[model samples]
Target: MEILFYIVPALMIALASCAVAAVIRRSLRISRAWNSGLTAEARCLRTYTTTSGGGDSSVRTTVHHVYAFTTRDGRGVRFEEQGGPGTTLEGDIVTVHYPADRPEHATARPPARGKLVAGTGCLLAFLGTFILFAVGFMVVTYAMFSAVGDFSQP
Candidate 1:
């Protein structure tokens, strides 16, 4: 029963680390997709105002929208633009890149801050998991060894 205390925590930490790694991998994949130019006729839509919160005193926030046209095998392919904040407005054409093989795989040029935010999040998650695992390991080892000494005494 006592062994479970150590094993469970270690397993949890390992799982958390794997989850963070998966996020990092996905981000990299998206970066590559954007660079490959898979989408067509990509254009930045006009900014729209959206209401946030409830009540008359609710704050109005500006959201930038973008549109992209994708085609496959010389045929028109249906694609939708997504993402919010820091996106380019309508009539303002932004650079759109995606993989040639996968026209649907695309993304707008993300702002520097966006990249920074994602990178920071991933770093923190990784570091946090590592620290938790290390501390747990040390604590478990110390407790186990101390128990051994206690048992030998009487």
Candidate 2:
């Protein structure tokens, strides 16, 4: 039971670290693609919305768009990704950045630094809250056991 006190906080920290690393890695990849001139004018082929969750209050919505383009070497590529709904429409042209070798792993644009910072800050805050709760629980449990003294039979 006491092991849980250590495990919860460690798990939260690990999750936060992984999330931050993913964000940085993605940012670097996007930067490299743009700087290397691996870009193409992709056309929006179709747009769709997906919904998930069971309860009324827990419903979630995501807008996904499918795009197709031709690379400089004359390779046709098609991919789907989540994006703003109204910002793009069927037949709208958008610039896509991707690696020369893997056109499937592409992004519509570079990530916004401001949004990244805000997201990281939020993640850290969430981790901090869980750590505090775990520590508080451990302290309270220890205090209760100490006050009750040892239970032994003679």
Candidate 3:
């Protein structure tokens, strides 16, 4: 219906904004990891895959990983990464990065340019959708108003 034209774009734009926020936050976090001066060796404690939300329309599987590391001051930290799995395997030694003052906030080093590209991609997609919605809204409103004027011309 005509009402859908207005409602759908509003919903899409709102959802897209959330996606943009998530991508930006993730990119900033990864950028911090890459820029940190402190480094340590971490081991992948475990890796597993989980399947969910898959039905007739879509099927998806996500990989989960856990890592453990020790800082220079002999402080130990363990975390579960929620960004799916990386190339590391259980017991594999991986490089970690963290602010020297916050060794407890360490994260595995992401590949060069990976986070930037992902954030850029999300932004571009959102921009495209926004442009499309704006154009559609203008066209629909213009047509509707024109039709009303035509009817009023008796």
Candidate 4:
């Protein structure tokens, strides 16, 4: 339908904006943690892969690692590291950064640039969709006016 032309692009733009905002928010949080200067040597306790989908659709596998570390105060913390600098084998040692107040919320040292890249890509998508819609609207308007011929006086 003609309405879909407007609805689809609006939805795409909204989705892209949401994605970009999420990436920026996450990046800021990680930046804060990185700047906190609290760090520890974490050990990968275990590694696992989760697979989803079958039959009709292709399966997607996500790798997750559980890491344990001790804070400066000797508090032991274990958490699942998601989507960054993943370690494939158990017992691998890596450095992690965290806020003193929130030791459980940590990030791997030398944070991955994937978030930044994703944010940029989403922002570009948002801009591209917006421009495409604007040009489309203008062309449609011009075509409509041209088809109507002169209307000033006759």
Name the better of 2 and 4 by TM-score.
2
Ranking by lDDT: 4, 2, 3, 1
CA error at residue 88 for candidate 2, angstroms: 1.7
All candidates: CA RMSD (Å):
6.9, 4.1, 4.1, 5.7
Error of 3 at 128 (Å): 4.2
- Backbone clash count, each prediction separately: 8, 0, 0, 0
Best-matching candidate per TM-score: 3
Off by over 4 Å in 4: 50-62, 84-88, 111-154
Write model 3 residue lDDT over 1-154, tens digit each, in one string: 4556566777876676777777777676666766876788888999888777756757667777788888888888887775544576899987888766666556775556775777678786867778677668857876986676644354
- Clash pairs (backbone) in predicted model 4: none
lDDT of 4 by residue, 18-95 (tens): 765776676767776787888899988888888899999999878788889999999999988665454457888888
Runs in model 2 lying further than 4 Å from the true structure = 52-58, 110-154
Query: Which lDDT value does model 1 have at 105?
Result: 52
Q: Higher lDDT: candidate 1 or 2?
A: 2
Looking at model 2, the pairs that clash are: none
How large an RMSD does model 3 have?
4.1
